[model samples]
Target chain A: MALPPYAGPLETTWYYGFRFLCACIFIFLITPILVIIPLSFNVEPYFTFTEGMLAFDPDSYSLRWYRDFVNNTQWRHSVENSFIIAISSTILATFLGTMAALGLSKSHMPYRSLMMGLLISPMIVPLIISAAGMYFFYSNIGLDQTYLGIILAHTALGTPFVVITVTATLVGFDHSLTRASANLGASPTVTFFKVIMPLILPGVISGALFAFVTSFDEVVVVLFLAGFEQRTIPRQMWSGIREQISPTILAVATILVMFSVVLLAALELLRRRNNRLRGIV
Target chain B: MANEIIGGDVVLAADGTPLKASLNKAMRKNRIRALLLVTPLFLFIVFSFLIPIVEMTFRSVDNWQVGTLMPKTTTALAGWDGKALPDEPVFAALIQDLQAGAKAREIGKVGTRLNYEKSGLRGMITRSGKKSLKVKEGPYKEKILKMHKKWKDLETWTVIKRNTAPYTMGYYLNAVDMKYDKSGEIVMRDENRRIYGKLFLRTFAISMAITLICVMLAYPIAYLLATLPLRYSNLLMIFVLLPFWTSLLVRTTAWIVMLQSQGVLNDLFVFFGLVSDDNRLQLIYNLTGTIVAMTHILLPFMVLPLYSVMKTISPSYMCAALSLGANPMVAFIRVYMPQTLSGIVAGSILVFILSIGYYITPALVGGTDGTLISNQIAYHMQKSLNWGLAGALGALLLSSVLALYLIYNKIVGVDNMRFG
Candidate 1:
């Protein structure tokens, strides 16, 4: 697995050339995302760079699109429903996925591998198949076309992620801490709530954040199961892209990118803290 | 304490003996509790995910159509051979059998349901024998052939006449675009039936290629973030995660708008003096656009895994190598790269596995040519109403993914890798 050393000019050039390609590609991939923010405030809506043109002007930097996005009834409703569904689904997925991770963490369990595979199977299966399966199952159960219907579906999809994250943190857990708490005369439930919960808090919080983002962004399954009342933001966005024309969508998209950036930064901070606490740094 | 250990007191006996390796025994005993802890997840998955998928999968092989009606004809035709043409009575019976299939809610049902799918089979089956053909009948074989050449084929007769042949591997074979010849052995597809299978492969290959591209792009950025000063790293990290909240539809649309003939990229090209004012590059509605958009969307999948791996590599190891007289590049290649292989492997496997099941990005950006295998499955489920074929394809995709998962585990122990 070792490579020849960069010994002389020929080797250094070869190494630097390969490294340069990597750097160039890495920059190219990141560029498309940054390109949008500037264009959002561009004098022209196009992504072209006009020579000798820079800085935001009231003429070029129009708030009209932003205003339109905020005022549009469909966009507003989608945002509202997206927040509601994401928060609700996050709660359900985090609680269920965390507890399930705990239960599975018990070394005495008989069906662990089989169980882990099943929990993650929802993730592995193609979304459209699950979309079809859920369509049939929910319709038969009389849960179709309802907010709870979408909630349960999203919860099912998101729970595996929670299980994955929490289970990961739990793998780093020290069994002796809980045992010591128990030996000190605290009950098992109290020990879990006080000692274990705090230790795994980052994992659970990150899991919840993931669940929220997933539910917020999910479109295919939502499109399949959601009714007019239950349509989440992604579903609504999909509709606008397909059936409507608007500069408002651009504004809304820009805001969404900013929001994701903020949330993801917070998530990274939590993760880094968790790593520091565990002394993995 | 040594005396106590020899005394076989509560602790000693509970822990077993020096001869027994008590730690090993204790771990052995705890393994079952581990399994028990994980059971509720198992049950939830069985009911919520596995059962539904398995039920759908079983439908692929189940001769549900033949089983439902004319139980007698199902029995009679169970072993009926297609040698010197079907008998006159058997031909009459087939007309009745087709009617019975339609009545049983099997034939002409779901396939042909989606817009993008080619519903060739559904149209043929549903449209068949609506008005019996008045063949010029000097030859009985030619007369039967006049109605349909497909019916003259032996495999078609066997497919229709079989009972609930739960053992039928027909669906499994067709899932990969291979099917049984008249002798009932799997073979490569007929020359005429080439494009559908080729499209599936093209989709799979494109996804794999995109996954590779994403890994190549994301690894360095993840490496920089992992190693760099915290302040700058955080800023870069935010940009990396920025697009997640941006609706994928919006991102995809942005790409479309930029890549289109008269779109932003064209304007940029002209303005930059890279090309003539009017000329535009073909970008959208091709394999390249699909690949670019998908790679953009899934870059995070690669970055997070690579970052986690890189983070665990102690800076001291590289410093140690440099101090030992190795140059920076050599130190990284020999020491750091090997350490980060676990991450690269993990990121590659994760991205590759997810890519195969991709649908929307390809559907939006690739157009007709860019469609992945999943699109075909969706088409079968929705448009063609060929739940059977859809289910078969689903099983095929699942098995391949599972195989890849197993391979990944072997290469880098699954339990060791942190997905975050």
Candidate 2:
């Protein structure tokens, strides 16, 4: 707010003080993320600023950790596994969740609330419990420690984001357009593709991204369900941090921070596109 | 077009079919179609998610291992009174069952299961199983007592008899720091062995502390974002959303870098003469580290809901209060604060629930004293190989979280939940 000239010193001080407080909070939020980027580049294997780094000497920086992260076979395997599990689960979750969202949005759907609760519960329930339960059940069924088990477990965890996001997109959907297409002798499948798909595609994509991230970032369930061969990035990082303190983790963390930035940008764009499609912008 | 009245109450369409019947048929078709669309996912979740948790809950009270292993002994022991141990028939049945159990190599499972109740019984059962195979005659009580001194104790028999029943509350009792004592009475565990009750209380206390810190830290920024012009607020929103979007492990890793004993924070403090380098503060792998990292991770949860609520609040109300002669602090507290109660409650409960069940961040940073109940549950599940106790602890944690979730759903509709 613009300050009025008639404001007293107390008001001015409180306003500036409050703004400063907020600025500090924002700094607190961003500093940890920002601090790692430079630390990840430090030539020394320390997390703090060395004298050379503070002096802005070019010798203070190196890509050793980044190179180590890329060259390590374990890290490479984890990255591959992360993408494999994330992509497969996201696809499965998106398909199942999109259909469920469509049904849930229909006014004629019976017991929609109850169905929604059950579908979204995986997101709400504690991950450890879900993992523990899955560990027992999947082992009994001979699926535990298998790739398929981890993928299916992740899909179950990821589906709620798909349902929530897709249902949100469907909220502003115009039903008459689909009805009009049906009335023109088009079959339900054809109308869904030509009319409904184009409008909700952004929502579906963003929902898929959400599901992808959920699977990508999840480690607890993976810890329970994954074999050593199926270790993902977070799982790898978890053990690395516990077993050894190294800048390689920071380098990886920096890379993940950048990846999230890209995902965040994509989500923002999708949101804008969604709002424009719904005529809210 | 003909609008025909067929029966006294029936209205017919131009096709001569009753309109009410047509409407009902169309509605039923839509309902079926909707249900069909949902059925695949509904069944998938039930099979993959719901059933597993139900099975886990059942495992908490499931005590069939002993009964299955020693069926003959269980039935024979059922008839004997608890006074001064069982008669010779009970001992005879026990020897018979132990010999068979040893031959099947399943006595180990029974021993392991019973070990959760009385620690030393595992050795006794295994020893008795080995010794019982040598005995070929009746008068087995003297032989069994001679095999192991533990067999002479009445408490051992009491525990064995209590577990022979297919379902028992023993696991749940152990979960809450209570177990059956020597006289077969439920009592709190000895002071040195009690862990879960204290862990539960600590989890609650830590979660509440984190929630309060989040609210305090998030309020000013949420207010600033809510009050600023759209352009500024939109830019400032990134500071919140970036952290919200970052991996939980990444944020936790950042905190470790910043808060560890030879880390940047300590280095800076040492450089600034705040403390000598020889005695750096022990900040991480403890409660302070857990609180600091969790507050950072959970701050966005508080900010998002508060900002959403604050965005709906009009600025004119504050201006009106200011013009009405009430001081700004009083006006903000009395007039503006009440409007944000729903956001405050929703955010607090959401953070509290999330914090209570938190595993990754705390597991990484929370050393023995700072660890929550979930970590203990994981310990039992993995390290201790005590699935029954893990299930019991998980069931308790799940119920409390679900209860809070239901309350959150009541206050703030779950559909309104949004994430960046």
Candidate 3:
């Protein structure tokens, strides 16, 4: 907003002061994420920058930490585990969540609020509690320390986002289009594919991205359900941070920051596309 | 429209069904279709998510160790008064149960369970179980008493008798920092052993502190973001969304790199002569580190809601108050602040709920004084192997979280929750 050119000197000072305060808050919000990138490249294996690096000396920075992360077999295995679990869980969450969201958004849906609460409880409940519960139950059923168990847990955790986002997209949907397709003798499956899917695809994709990120970033459940054979990226990073104070974790953190940047940009694009399809933009 | 009756007062479908009946049939089919679609996820959640939590809650009081492993002794102790030691028949039953339990290698489980109630009971039970295997004949009371001094005390019998049931409140009692004294009356645990009570209080206090700090920091930024031009605001929103998108472990790691003694912030402080190099500030691994890191992580939860609410509050309300002779600050407080109260409440509760259950960041950054209840729960689950106590603590924390969640649902409506 433009500052009003009120003649009062006090108002003038307050205007710039307010902006300055907000700028500092913004820096506080972002600085920690930005700080790790430069620290990751430090040659001395310290969290702080070296004098040579501060002076723009090329010799002071190295890719050794990145090399260590790549060369390390456990880190590589964890990356593979993270992807396999995240992808599998995302697919399951999206499929089940989309079907459920479509049903929940219908006016004829019975006990809609109660059903929604039950489905989304996984997201709202504390992770530690969920992990503890799953640990005991999964152990009893012999599912603990298995990839299938962790994947199922992540799917349960991720479906709430899909349900929420897809249902949100469905709110602006026009049911008459589906009725028209039916009137034209198109079957229900054809109508879903030809009419509804195109319109809500952005929301579905956004939901899938959310699911992927949730599973990818999840550690509490992994810590409980996963053994050595099933360690995900976050689980590996946890032990890395706790057992060893190395710049290799900072290197991984820098890579994660960039990865999040990509995810954020994709979500923004989906949000805009969803808004435009609904004619809100 | 198809089901509407004309002036003839009767209508039929193509299949000759009554119009009203056909319409009801169609509606019922639609309802069934919707229900069918939702059933899979509903069942999946019930089995995978809800049942497990219920099982955990049940485990807090599910006592099977003493009763199952020492069945003979449990039955024999039923007739003995808890005020005094038992007779030879009870001792004979105990020796028989102990020999059987030791052969099965399950007496250790019973010992571990009883040790939770009374110190040295684990040693006494296991030691007696091993030695009882060698004692073959009668007059077992004196021999069993001589095997362990704890057997001579009447409290040992009381503990065994108390745990004979299929379910016991011993785990729940321990969780709340209360225990059964020698008289079998519940009393507060000795002062040094009372950890859970202080841990619960500290968890709440830390969460409250983080919530207040988030509000203070998030308000101005959200206000500015909401009121700014669309282009500028879109660019600025990245600062909030990026962190929200980043992995939690990554953020905690970032805080570690930034707050450690030899880290960036301390380096800057030393460079500016704020403190000497020999006396770098201990920012990480304490309460300060937990608060700063958690506030940074949870700030977006505060900002997004407040920003969404503020964006809908038209600027004219503030302008009207200012033009009506109120000072700008007064107008802002009375009009603008009141309008944003819902956002404030929503964000505060969301942050508080999240912070109270936080584990990863606190475990990594928070040292002894800073760890929350969740960390203690994790410790018991992983290290102490006391799943019962963990379940009890989890149930307590879960109940509080569920209570707050209901309030949050009432205020904000979970359907309205959005993610960047």
Ranking by DockQ: 3, 2, 1
**Per-residue lDDT of candidate 1, residues A10-41 (tens digit):** 77676577657756755555556565555565
Error of 2 at A190 (Å): 2.2
lDDT of 2 by residue, B14-79 (tens): 576788777788899999999999988999999999999999989999999889999988999887
Q: Write out fnat for all predictions, comma-separated.
A: 0.42, 0.78, 0.88
Q: lDDT by residue for model 2 over A1-281, one digit each (tens)?
A: 77889999999999899999999999999999999999999999887888999999999999999999999999999999999999999999999999999999999999888889999999989999999999999999999888899999999999999899889889889999998998899999999999999998988998899899999999999999899999999999999889987899999999999999999999889889988888889
Q: TM-score for each prediction? A: 0.82, 0.98, 0.98
Q: What is model 1's DockQ versus the real complex? A: 0.39
Residue B334 error, candidate 3, Å: 0.6
Expressed as tens digits, the lDDT of each residue in B1-420 for candidate 1 is: 233355544355434465356756667767755555555556666766667677777767765444554454555566567454566656555556555655655554422221112224445555553423332233444444555556566655554553334345656666666765556556877778765567668867887798888877887778778977777776766556666445687687678667777667777787698878667788788877888888887888788888888988899999899899998779989999998887788888878888888877776778777778888888877776777777778777777788888778788654555543
Question: Which candidate number has the best DockQ?
Answer: 3
Candidate 3 lDDT, B343-371, residue by residue in tens: 99999999999999999999999988889
Q: Residue B51 of model 3: what lDDT?
A: 100
Better of 1 and 2 by DockQ: 2
| Residue-level lDDT tens digits of model 3 in A1-281 | 78776548898888899999999998888999999999899898787889998998999999999999999999999999999999999999999999999999889999999999999999889999999999999999999999999999999999999999999899889999999999999999999999999998998999999999999999999999999999999999999999988899999999999999989888888889888888899
* Runs with alpha carbons beyond 4 Å of true place in candidate 3: B1-14
Looking at candidate 3, what is the lDDT of residue B210?
99
Candidate 1 chain B, run of 10 with poorest lDDT: B110-119
Give me the candidate number with maximum lDDT: 3
> Candidate 2, chain A: TM-score?
0.98
